[model samples]
Target: MAVTILGMDIGGTNLRSGFVNDRFELSEFRISSSQAICGEKAPENIAAYIERLMAETGIRPDAISIGFPSTLDKARKRLLSTPNLEGLDDMNMVERLENALHIPVYIDRDVNLLFLCDCHANHLTADVIIGCYVGTGFGNVIAIGGEILVGKNGVAAELGHIPVRGLTLDCPCGNVGCVEMIASGKALKTLQETWYPEEAIGTLFTLHASDEPVRGFINDLALPIATEINILDPDEIILGGGVLQMDGFPKGALEDAIRLHARKPYPEQALRFHYSGEKQENGVIGAAILAFRHMKREKGQPV
Candidate 1:
């Protein structure tokens, strides 16, 4: 029998959910406001939402997978911190949801799920892959041999938080000098408002491609990526996010900057870069894929 999986992507702004079958067909897609659903008694509210989804579709899920833009514990059972979703920190989401739905539940950082989906869609067969997404903030995920690498502290691959000297801006993570402070969409917006007040933020890259400050910003964006490449030497790197997808964003220039800062000789020359386009369904699809894989592994079946 084909497995039916329920996948949910909980973002800062929206909560998206969908059902995926074994053949990767998606149906019953729904989107809702994150804030409205995360009210007091959030766990109960989320469980009710899932129950309603199942009742309406008449298709009970074999397993549930959720992706959150937050830090999770090593076991992936509890959320360690959620900066955007207030009152969700330290919540035992997996336990609560599983108890309510009477099904297995799995959870992970949203970026990891996105990387999983991108890899599967791109047919990237590399044993080691790194995904760097420059969205509202810098999101990163590292996979080795098709499995995510969660360090002992369960906070591995936090490429965004890598400190950069001389950058004094405060990061939402309560740290100063983090690379994300100067290289993410938030940074670009600040620059757009400060330097090009008359121009729309979305068109900043298209209008000022040759501006020195813009070039410097692009360089800053590539520095953390190159640093990761030098440290991990992964077989392939996937770069994407809202920032890169902006109108007339300089993809080639960013690629060149990454190569320029990457280590000379060896891996730099051998590196394979894949740029993923923005997909609204990627998060939900990724959650389903991860859940399917997790279920198969638990059954001692080959994936």
Candidate 2:
């Protein structure tokens, strides 16, 4: 029988899980709502969720790996904080889950998981890759030499909260003018409400080629990418998220805008663009990769 690892990706709205072998071939992928938990009930409900998944799959996992949309602590043993998911912040997930399940648990910020996905899926040659995903929110994950740049607090890559133009918009993290507010799904909604009051989101891209307001919103959102590029100068930049998947979206326009704002010396010439397509399986795949890597590390092996 193949040794399998269980993986979970916990987001604000969705919780995704899967099982995979050493090669990252996923099996028994499942997605469920995050509404099953509230405050102190989260650990209990999360345990139930994992048990149900295992029961459904009939797979006894060798280990468990989880990705949280939050900052992990210095030791990677505690959940330090999460700007979006309030209940998970300051929670001792590593200890609680490991004790509850009798399995080793590994957790990291979700953006780092995205970076792992991009590296494996794209077969990127660059040693340093920066992944910027703009969706319901914005997130960043930076990896150098095939390892994550986990800082002292494991909160190194909070790239989306960096202030720009001091523009104040209400952010879920209780901050004003966060990069997410200016560049994320919320930003898209704000722009739609302000400029294209009569248009639907699915059609915004299609209409933008001719509509002034839609065009303006796209350009405005592109500014955040410009800011990130100017600072990080990543060896390779991967852009993925829901907004980029819209029909008739102007891919060339966004790339050109990014290039225009990036530094001329390196980032402009080496910038790489990738759309994650419309598949919802990315989270599951990423989760699987996380588990596979962790299992290898624990076994005194290399990934």
RMSD of each: 1.3, 2.0
Please give each candidate's TM-score. 0.96, 0.92
Per-residue lDDT tens digits for candidate 1, residues 1-303, read 888889999888889999988888899888898887685687888889899888998989889999998999998899888877876788899999889989999999988888888998899878889999998899998888878899996889889999988889999888999999899988999998889999899888888977987998899999999999998999999998889888888888888898899998966799898987587778889999899888888889976
lDDT of 2: 0.75
Q: For model 2, what is the error of residue 9's alpha carbon versus the real structure, in angstroms, after optimal superposition?
A: 1.7
Q: Model 2 compared with the native: what TM-score?
A: 0.92
Error of 1 at 70 (Å): 0.7
| Candidate 2 off by > 4 Å | none
TM-score of 1: 0.96
- Residue-by-residue lDDT tens digits, candidate 2, 15-102: 8888877777787877888666546577777877888777887888887878787778866778877765647878889888888888
Best by TM-score: 1
Candidate 2: 10-residue stretch with minimal lDDT? 275-284
For model 1, the local distance difference test gives 0.88
Clash tally for model 2? 1
What is the Å distance of residue 42 in model 2 from its true position? Answer: 0.5
